[model samples]
Target: MKIEQQYFENLLEEGSEEFELIFRSLFKEKYENLYSLLDDTDAFNEPMICAAFSTPIHIPVEQMVLGFLEPLPSKIDVVSNKHGVVHIPKLGYFYTNEPCESLEIRIKDNNSFAIFKSDKEVELISFKEEVYINDTDIEICRSEDESIIQFFPDQTENIQLESGLEKSVMHLNNAYHLIKKHTPFYAEWLNYTMRRIVLFTSPQLNSFASICTLNNAYINLNNERVSDIFFLEEITHQCGHALFYPMSIDRDKLFIMDYTTPMSHFSGIETDDRDLINAFYSFFPQYTGNYIFDVILDHEENLDEDSRLELIGRYAFRMYKYGLGIYQYQEYSDQILSEYGKEMFAIFREGYEKLYEKRKELFDSLDIKDQVYVFDLEKFKSKNLQKTI
Candidate 1:
């Protein structure tokens, strides 16, 4: 894992004269260690390394490299020098460093550039600007007023940022505070797993928030359709998806294999199919809702009964959404028990029923209008369970 500091220093001191030899040796060693750490050896190819480093989450790459390298006198600023060449000021430079005729810079931005190199020619491959918030790099296109249009760098053409995007970011930060104060586990999980939240403008296509496991990020639409509680719900919900990544790594797949049919749920009049992993993941948002309710109830002595009721109702609605999913997937509980055992199933079923009961009690206590507003059970009913994929 250790990178030779003296060698890099010598490379920098000698500049282009020693660039080819130093870069080939240094980059090969550094990338091998990084690939080993990530459990991904294929990414060490020249094209893959170029692509990975150009993306926003390349901090993980920086982490792997810097983790073993000797500390420099000051932070090395990243800069591009020539075609297919990037200079890490005071550290060293990386380049093809060969005779070339046709050179192309595909894209050039302030922070990074992409280039293509061969023995005959070096060319600019592409370029992108990365925005960093709180030292975490984000892929976003900014407006004149500094408003953000966030999207995954790879899918910029398919997605666009919505109007009032700034407001959504504000709400996201507010939800982060609520999570940090109320759900310490989610807060901690997010610190390690969750990478970024990409915002989309089209409501018809992205009415509900979603998480993608491959990127370790959330993709949410800027639809002003729900309360702040909903934002917190999505945050915790997506964090749950992120949590499953590490949790599933060494686990047995028997339960999922046995229960391969998708579970149905309703967002409005439309029905959607959720896979076995997602059906199980529903437990997380329900757990998050219960945790938020507990935190509020812990301060019940200082609040009026009306305030308490409203808070409980809001969180209960969130819990009910996930509880309903669990209810729909209950038939597969035995399969889960068979694979994971009785104790695990018991713990899951307990939380599942507890949320259902709590939602029932909260709904019954409300007046007819409040009940109508809070308990939308119409969304939970599945017309058919026999449909298989």
Candidate 2:
């Protein structure tokens, strides 16, 4: 468990033979189990090797591991001026006692890059969330050791109060996902901007909400407080833009794609990485990276950027009361709409209230005092009136 930092740093620093050894060993488990060498091919291109072994690898293997100095059976092990000492566990992978001075890795599925630090544990940092709100100040102190990752808030950001990040890592299926659906979030109420609502229907886990980063979008679904009270909070947070986004941005913004709706939602694909921006009214909703906004009824979008984000937040709040999850009530004849006078809101409304009540009963039983944003229809209506019409 304890490793010498200087040892691994040498691999890349000096291009030492040991560096190659370490990489080959560590990656053996990956190539042996996860890869297939189809033809009589002994070695692949460096990129191909790195792709199979450890992806988002700084120097994509491009022939580092299987570049046959000996037969494919005999592996290489050496010490480099840069990489201290390495031992290849398998032909294409290596393990070392030290951390590489500098390494870059990306999730093969998402291609999100992380700068590997030369610490005892493998560490990666994310500045997008931090820099988006404040540049000079550190935004997130997220760190990880091996598969388990943690989220932390920076001290110097000038943001008052502290957030104790919850840590949970699961090597479930493809990758590790650590979710935070718990709070005070510092006792901060679940407004549209920060709401966790999830509706998971996996064979393994039937969950209401969770927070995780996937290939497409950063997603967070909260139910840790009310535990299924507002099942749509997270979903609506992302989908609200589908209703409130303005088509045009008055000022240039970096992250806000497509006035209110993402390019994916308009395009109709549930999740796509390359093409982002729903320029054409296709209404394909982005289902990844903070995807929770529910947009089936309200169609008018924001032409200006300011109006778009504001409306997004507003509509997200609306989802606390109305989301597709609740509207699935069998009693409603025309589920999407309830007509001018007669309200089917009561149908979904009644069901959600029951769900909320059930959650409250559970919370009371558990003695948890977290505050959940209860959907008060009257108050929600009043809040909507203040928005710029």
Candidate 3:
């Protein structure tokens, strides 16, 4: 399975229609019979439908496929995307209006079941998970089935879940506008890849810890004061990993070893090459977002003084991680990337180098000594205020 360099490069490029078609073709091949059977369903044709096959949080593809083996109104266990909504195979969806994990639903039993609503045809079931934390109820943001943005209930006294969720959503919207305004292709790429955003509290992390698998991103928001630029960096970084996962499904095509090798858990232990490459690749887009922020801070006016300074500080913090990621992964890439993978790595490195050169002056202006790994608003503002902000 000798894939071309263009295929690898296009996958990293983030907005290649050709690569999207390639992904669909590969996905179809993986589930040939199932794909053909449910080709006409609206659920199968969604832009972000690939998200359903992701690990940890996913609508089980096997169960949906198995549902087709039975009759039209078969009994199948389906998981809800948000709280109470479930998408049935062949038939439409049903709502339960409560927290749910998985429930058995009668697809189209006219005689044996009662309709919950007149418009949609789905039989309701009796299975609900209580949505509570410390005897307090928390709200869930139920967006469309294609994409969901959810927040974890407050765990600590300092944690303000409602305010944090609202502000994070605003930052996500603003980040999309920045990407669209600067790089429209990147914005479209984000729409196609990112499916869910989960904001939670993590006391162990100083500022935050964000990790993404497939279309889902889990962001720890233990820190109170997060800048607008922080969202820009994490959104792109997490989504970048989401996009890269499917592309590397065929291990022989991209890597010398099995690409699905689990990451090392022990401290100072070497991780698999796949993890290293993906980590470095995720930073490529983060740097692109940084580049966009630089342009925004330089040209865009009427921004609040504090906001500008905040962005500059976070931008500097993100830039350090972006550079360090690529530097750490350079040796691993040389050891494990196949011929096609090498070409892709070369292209990614070249892209980062270009952005680095352009941002040289901005880098020189920042006080590197005061810059910290975790986002510190005061430290960032104090050290990075040398500029016109």
Candidate 4:
């Protein structure tokens, strides 16, 4: 579902007094007109505006608001200086001289770059039509001097190499083609939610892709790992999180009714308070995975029998995971349904049960023995029910 203008208005009206004051102070004359543009702009960008109001960090709202209006850049340099200041040439920079709990950056305008903790602004020098930055005795050419760019972490030497960038772009193009061809709805969602994809060499060996809380999706797919199905799953999964994130902020307590107690999923992944909230709402991403496989299976003639079975197994596994998760976390899910009403829950339940039945039929036909992809529904359901008792 798309975020409407009224949602933005409600967000402003229901904001805390301090939030309203900062918003009004920063936006001044333009604050009233800003909400009208929310529906027309990128959905992912909405969270930044919400963050400007909610976050305790003393960020300049004018800069953040302006950055949202500008078109997202395809590439950006994530520069970390010797003084422990992380700079993203355009979007923002932060001081990380000491260890911190959070790694949030302060939003800055495209014209300026912050150096260290000095709060100094280094202006990009323009020569003819090109923009150059001469900072710390190093000179680099910038494609656009005044355009705001988004950056992500984990940019290692290997990831920054020209070859890696090309490979990442190629994977993205393949992903776009698959989304456009097979999942048109997801393509539209991507157009609205995904601003840009940033390539990074992930520190975690298994991490392939992730969406930063704001506008960028960070991917670490190498040449060998890049495939249409892989990219499609990653994009759709991350896009689901990106789409719902902004809504969670605007509609307070939309995902979780209680932030006091921690919760664990059926998979035994223990979530802390903050992460527990996210875990509670993870059904959307699982649903996306199931949806993608369903769409792909429609053209089963193009796939070999093994590939078809593999896709079916994945779909079944996602549905099983989602259904089992809901069954295990019924208390929390019930609260969410009661508060937000039954719309989302209805979708989750209907999809999960239908897919569960279909998966059982497929399992019998295929005689699948692989435990990784094929889920044992009866076993998990019985175990989950015992847990509740």
Candidate 5:
């Protein structure tokens, strides 16, 4: 049987009680039908409803409480927890989990160093006190300078410490809170992304999947509600980039676009250029089916230079190629360009005239005059450059 099925069965066998209690308790009001359906975890994985069904399932209890309702009334001021303090909104101070360490996070609440011990026990410490911050044990944020004591992990990205709070507090505090609250969900999310769909990878990649949230951009799971559902879909998109982010984006090694010289690489869209479009077509015939590509390359048939460049950001051949490696290049297509072969990549030419105008418009608007990397057009055209048949 498929692993998906096995996963469902396991949920039923072991997760039934937890699932029922959690579902009923949380969805008692808004999602009555969905809560009722919780009796069958197996049915929840149905294809059509899976997307819609799973959408709401993402709103775990704390997310609901933290995201929607305020856990506490405005009048209350103390926020305490043994499980660790998660700074909830008007829910102002609700400790979702117990504090693991006796972390004394000091914050300036009322012009005084209101030291927080385990999300509870607020103490006013004198500025003159020999307050030594335990980098590993406690996280501190005050006067706009929030810091995780002295955390400078060896492999972390090196960012210059800017002055004040921007360098410290907010992000780390928020990240810690989000990661603490959503560890399980994060693990499951990583599992979904790294499962069968990750056609080719190494243990390093599998490990990297867990560390994705560590990227400051996605540190806080709650902020993923930007574009459509807060840029959450974009999260997967970025992870897709990360999953295949190669040291060198080369067609010989990765799927991508090819262009020589920094200036010609992406300064502007080469409109109605049969050479460029034909080159694009020579690699990715799947563009015929991609809606976004179709809109930019196949639909808007009469775009000028300015128009084409504007839509440049939307049309990334590498992204399309990544999709190809993911869904198309595998078992789906028999077409061979050899090892890294593409079937003539001629499909992109079929709608050339029709797509030329719009595609140029997209390319024209883009200001990519600064990609110093020696980007190979074919390499630039592919998605995941690390796969082999």
Candidate 6:
């Protein structure tokens, strides 16, 4: 089945409904008859409830479930995870010492909240980090201590390093504006599914990397300076993963076999078929982004020669990488993908193949020789452009 715009609309509706069902079931399992005692069940719509459902924390599930208790306690001690932070829905996070479990929270007659720890009772401090980029609201935060880490081909140390939020925010704003202008579909997709942009750093993570933290409403990004094109590639890629993740919760209807069964090592590491399909889905949309750069080159009058080549180099470089993924994965896609999976894969494949053929001459003109090149403009020009002798 060819994927139309309606497919995304359907997918969003289906996935959201399924996640809510899963949450209700789990809530019932946790609270049992107490679940029926709730006065307002609509508290389930709180984002942190969904975040806790998707995230694996060291604390008991009751810790999260209790946050939804209709009449919150006058003075209750909420347990912190190993991260030294307590996450409450609607209420923000509270910090404490590590290895500490209890934070005494008191709700005053005025309904103001306070934290009593270390023999001191003070007003609770909550930092809700949020910003508006391209008129879209997004929270800027870091991955929780207990959240699942991103998959990497090589084993590397992952720790949150110093990130310059000012610069990163500027770059993201520019990138989102460009995405809104050129790849409006992806922009809308991101606005729908993405809620948070988590930041971290690893020295071995190279310049930059990003991954969707399973079903959590966030994606992790390496803290580094990167081009606008890099942001375009990553923002679209991880948001696609985040958008499609919830549907996998309904595994029985979506797959014929165990959805987690190891199926391929397209990234030089064993990955399940479900993940592989997501990766392919992630790559397909970037070609539209690649074409946008082509349009800018042909029509934009303000671009100097150096700026023009930089865009061209980015176009050629990404096309090669995206093309290679389709070539390698297309062979094995049918072996494991379900009918639904195959239909989606076909759309990705057909969409990319059309663009590849349409840009055949430009693709042939690129003399890129390295397989592991980043957006190295100087190297690309040296290899692809003739020198004036």
Among the numbered candidates, top lDDT falls to 6
Candidate 6 lDDT tens digits, 150-188: 333222454442253444667678767776775577677
Candidate 3's residue-wise lDDT over 1-389, tens digit each?
Answer: 11233554565454434445554575588778666665543334232344443323345564444323434544455566444666433233455663345555444465243233334544465332322111111112222233232122221233343345656766656655665666655666555544445455556543222222244555556654655566666666555565565555444665666554433421245644435444545654554566666677767675677777777776666676667666655656656668887766665666566666776788768875565545677776665676634
Report the C-alpha lDDT of model 5 over 1-389, residue by residue, as the tens digit: 00122332343334333433433454546556544534443222111122222333211222223213222212222332222343322112333233433334343444233445546754333232111112222212121011111122222332222222233344333322332233333323333322111111112221112221111111122211112111122223333232221111233322233322222133244442323222332232222223233433344554454333322323443333434333322342233233332322322333332344444554344333332122222332243222210
On a 0 to 100 scale, what is the lDDT of residue 220 in model 1? 50
In candidate 2 the C-alpha lDDT for residue 302 amounts to 23
Candidate 2 — worst ten consecutive residues by lDDT sum? 168-177
Q: TM-score for every candidate vs. truth?
A: 0.52, 0.22, 0.61, 0.54, 0.27, 0.71
> Residues 26-98, candidate 2, lDDT per residue (tens digit)?
5555555423441233333122242334323333232244332233422122221122212121221222333
lDDT of 4 by residue, 1-389 (tens): 12232442343234433333444454445464654443343322433354443343223333344334545423222333333333233233344442222123333456433232233333322212211111111112112111112222222333442244455545456556665677665565556444444444533432222322343344554333554455555566655565555444433445545433456432345543434455555776666557667667765356644344445554555555676666755655655434563455556566666655654555334332344422443443333333222
Ranking by lDDT: 6, 3, 4, 1, 5, 2
Clashes of 4: 0
| Candidate 5 worst ten-residue window by lDDT | 141-150
* Model 4 pairs whose backbones collide: none
C-alpha lDDT of residue 382 in model 1: 27
Cα lDDT, all candidates: 0.41, 0.26, 0.51, 0.43, 0.29, 0.56
- For model 4, the stretches where C-alpha displacement exceeds 4 angstroms are 1-164, 205-212, 222-224, 250-256, 265-276, 300-310, 335-337, 363-389
Name the best candidate (by TM-score).
Answer: 6
lDDT of 6 at 157: 52
Off by over 4 Å in 6: 1-3, 32-56, 59-76, 79-101, 107-113, 122-134, 142-158, 161-166, 204-224, 247-312, 369-378, 381-389
